[model samples]
Target: MTSAEASAELRFDPPGPGSYKQDPVHFPRAATRYWAETHPPAFARGTADFASTYGMLLGGLQTAYVNGIAYIVTLPAPEEEVPQRFQRAEEAMTGKLWREQLREWDEICKPESIARHRELQSIDPDALSDEELAGYLTRCRDHHSAMITQHMRFTASAVVPTGDFLAHVGDWTDLPPAELLGLMRGASPVSAGASAELERLIAALRQDTSAQALLASDDDPGDVLAALRDLDGDAGAAVSDYLDLVGNRLLDGFDICEPTALEMPDALLRAIRTAVDASDEADDVDARVAEVRDKVPAEHREQFDELLGEARLLYRLRDERGVFSDIWASGIMRRAALGAGRRLAAAGRIHEPEHIVDATLDEMCALLAGAASPSADELAARAAYRATHTAKDAPPTLGPPPPPPPDDSKLPPMVARLMRATGMALGALFGSSEAEHEEHLLRGLAASPGVYEGTARLVSGPAEFGRIVKGDVLVTVSTTEAFNILLPLLGGIVTDSGGLLSHSAIVAREYGIPGVVGTREGTTRIADGARVRVDGAAGEVTVLA
Candidate 1:
């Protein structure tokens, strides 16, 4: 009431449709990030993908994930300066309470969290011995797992199929029959039959890029399909099986399928060798890309990216542009899609592999719109119509979050301990979904970068917060209203559970310290006083032994 005091800002609940207070599984950020799904990121652009290897392999995984869909009419277009707008709105509405809580959390959890981040980042991945590398990788994997396991929003954001995939679902049918087939092929599921079929087709791809490339260049993708159809009887069936396997996975891309660990998968290494062989025969890669580029329609030329994307999709599982990432995952998406489609056809349920990946939700409804299972050709037509005409769903708007949970000053000791543990535990285990057996940890992009060396105190639950040292890194999973008091004495922050916009990040920034938010398993993997370095810019942390 005094003139010296600033009037607290008013927080207004925005209108229309929005996501839950926060997603329970992924993307725990306060700001809305639905647009990040499926679409190319505004911040991280890349060269045009020429190989259907990974690019077109995209839409295969996007179609089935509903959570990636956002109601766009509610917010600014993706290209706008939305982050600043959100920050301002957030501050104004809650009297800057969220940021204020961030400051409070910073004062509570910073010191120790920051110390651990710096110590780990100082060590590099290359310098580690085999044992150290294994240990570090385990920590990384654990970091990823914790985020997925504890924070609902964190779990959703890191692994959701993506936004681009969601928008392009209706467009999958607009391409030529063969490219449609490739899309379906990429979406198929993996199976014993599909694997045998894939080997044969890949052998052909390894030997005959010229044959298919020639057809693609001439703008007659279906010609390539017809050629493929003429393969020796056994070989033809194998290819068909491969295409069907991919189709199934594409339709349900949101489902997680972690592959068993392998030093180098033969299927992928073969692709790289094939590319090298093709390029060696008189530098043909560029010429081939140009040939296909020229065939794209003048009016619809920009859409050529879809073709390139498909090419990249095939390559992503293996090549990764040139040098392979040691962390590359297995599982053949395109081949799997093809395999799934064949299975459906074998059961006499669908017509072909292409029909599934390219099947629009509307067309699927229309297919089922029939009293019984409709003919394959009829369903394909409806799908084609929807592909050319349907507009993608829009993103949901992000309004200001509700007022801060409560002040830290008045918190009881038990409540504060619980909140600290919740945040720390969630942060400690970020990525653990992809591996099999003892490979339980994962690595992820560290959003809030900082460094602080400290003794790591792993707290699996709330009861351990009482043992936190003033200079120690508080390792825990989730953070809530109660944990606010612990912030001031901490050196740095490491959470396995949240994103850049998560509570951990906000607090770290407020305290003017380094914060590696969304590490997932930071508490479990990084031991007490295990030196580490976290580079937010690089999205990695170096765990020093």
Candidate 2:
């Protein structure tokens, strides 16, 4: 089909009122009915919580889906609350309230979220009866929704301090965000797929010769993984523990429609192999920190140190919030849906088990309960459309244009600080700088420093991950924090969307790999297996072949 014809076929009226911008940063692909239906309310609640906590003039964000693409718009806060919000913003700026929020995340939020995920994951959906499975799906959906909100609730705390550091450091020195963000390299271990469980697994595997032999065996990847998980003693226990932490988590996107690690055994096994073979490399963080600090104006050096400390302190939350909050929960929900789908497919009720993910929660429950509405054919069609279409097929925006930003000149000093810090951080988080490029070259944000030339592996989704070998450059639409699990296998990363503060950029910097993001056409311009040079410092990708 022609581009215009496809666009027309997919176009639909806006869900409600107000201007809406596509959120390709999070949902680059078309969402399934299950995610589209449950995401909005939870997202709105979470953003509202962040706004109230930071005293923003905006109430929270609202989402709507058109042709399965998610779009978002900000709601306005009540006029009467503006004064109170201003007061609170002032207090938040001066007090650095994110510190308290950080402590809460570590001591309360992170642990509690992990516990909840473990509890839900422990239940075997296959063991439950039809009625019991329906109830379990309901619980999964509810928890998934709550986790979405939880992920958003800490959004401000995660972004503000990092943005504050960027803003201040940018003024004090002429360095780009990519260089400054390198200071955050050691902060978020989660972004590098590091966990205590992983460390333990590595240690145990090193000592257990039999487990090592099994991992290195030529047996089917699935069988190797199963044997590893069931192996005897500390080695097996450690492998099981590590899988419990990561196996159920989505390997790519955030939605229930995305496949979990366990679902992609080959890639998961490869990643495990890579992790086992990986060794610690020398870190130049201190030298880089000192070099950047020396460049800052003498008068601002002390303040720069303070700002850098705070940014690093809160940087882990960037990935931790999403990874701990909804990513795991969404996978659990997918597992339950797949369980129901398996039974339905076996009974000849659905065309395919995976198609059940395209159904709404109620529809899924009904299907499990043997209802005939939303027939198998209808869901199959939905799945086909979602697979065929993406954010590229949808309009960049919908409804009226967004209002201009409020002038900070007349705002109170503290309120201005709040607005400036939050605005700068958020803008860098989502906005890309490069807009145009030459035919052989794709320009984007210089997300990570250095340069690398390698074969471009075009991966549209997790299913394509197996094509990526060690030192291959990953070219795709975008990547979420969950992609970190497989990042060790890549030489570099290039994306069509996302900015310097994006997960793709953050993980690349943490891994010390060259990364050019927001190229807008990297996937289209660079062919798979084509040798391409990625000059991340220059924000350019050149197709040499």
Q: lDDT winner among the candidates? A: 2
| TM-score, one value per model | 0.24, 0.98
lDDT (tens digit, per residue) of candidate 2 on 162-274: 98898889988878887788788888999999999999998999899998899889899889999998889999999999999999999999988899999988888888888
| Candidate 2 off by > 4 Å | 2-4
- Per-candidate local distance difference test: 0.34, 0.90
lDDT (Cα, tens digit) per residue for candidate 1, span 141-165: 3322222121221111111111222
Query: Which has the greatest TM-score?
Result: 2
TM-score of 2: 0.98
Candidate 1 stretches with Cα past 4 Å from truth are: 1-253, 256-340, 343-351, 354-400, 408-411, 424-545
